[model samples]
Target: METKLKVGDKVTCDKFASLTHNFVGSIEKIYENSAVVEILEHHKDDTVVVSDFHNRAVVALNHMKKISA
Candidate 1:
């Protein structure tokens, strides 16, 4: 089933394409194919990922899994 996501929802994003590691964030905006995520947590070793993206990332819906409260 498709995961229903909305703004402010916490999610875990899978590593894909140019991303080197998985990350956790909250959805800031949603688009047809992707959503803008405001990075909240990530692996300490992947600090560069957060810095490079400036703590924001546009991730595809398929790559995101909603975190249950």
Candidate 2:
């Protein structure tokens, strides 16, 4: 299902590698099925791997969810 996401919304999404469990960021831009999330925090684990994604990434709307305060 597609979610209606707006800019500046805090969300949690996954990354390709880097042993991180989840990536926290605010929506920077929105597309048809994806949005650009400006990563603010990256929670990493013990395993390490080089990832292509940096400060921001185009994440699918379904893959992202609202962050509960």
Candidate 3:
């Protein structure tokens, strides 16, 4: 089911440790087992903005799921 989620796909993750993600973003890039989500925009998970990130946060593919249009 997770495999259906691909690069550029939008997702609504209900369980991402601390945030019930309603945020929408594209899968900027992917790897053999992970991806780099260039978080386009977030609603409330601004715990740390990308601008604040010293380095890009490449999240595990499992941490995100593709959402419908």
Clashing pairs in 3: 10-67, 11-67
lDDT for each candidate structure:
0.86, 0.73, 0.57
lDDT of 2 by residue, 1-69 (tens): 654578989998876544457778899998998999887777655123324455677888888898842
Cα error, residue 19 of model 3, in Å, equals 8.5
Q: Cα miss at 3, model 1 (Å)?
A: 2.5
- lDDT, residue 48, model 2: 32
* Lowest-sum lDDT 10-residue window in model 3: 13-22
> What tens-digit string does per-residue lDDT give for candidate 3 at 1-69?
336667667654333433444455677677877776666656555546545642234667666667653
lDDT of 3 at 58: 66
Report the number of the highest-lDDT candidate: 1
lDDT of 3 at 62: 68
| Candidate 2 runs further than 4 Å off | 1-3, 17-19, 44-54
Candidate 2: C-alpha lDDT: 0.73
Give TM-scores for every candidate, taking all chains together and pairing residue i with residue i: 0.86, 0.71, 0.58
lDDT comparison, 1 vs 2, better candidate: 1
Query: lDDT, candidate 2, residue 42?
Result: 74
Off-target runs (Cα >4 Å) in candidate 1 are: none
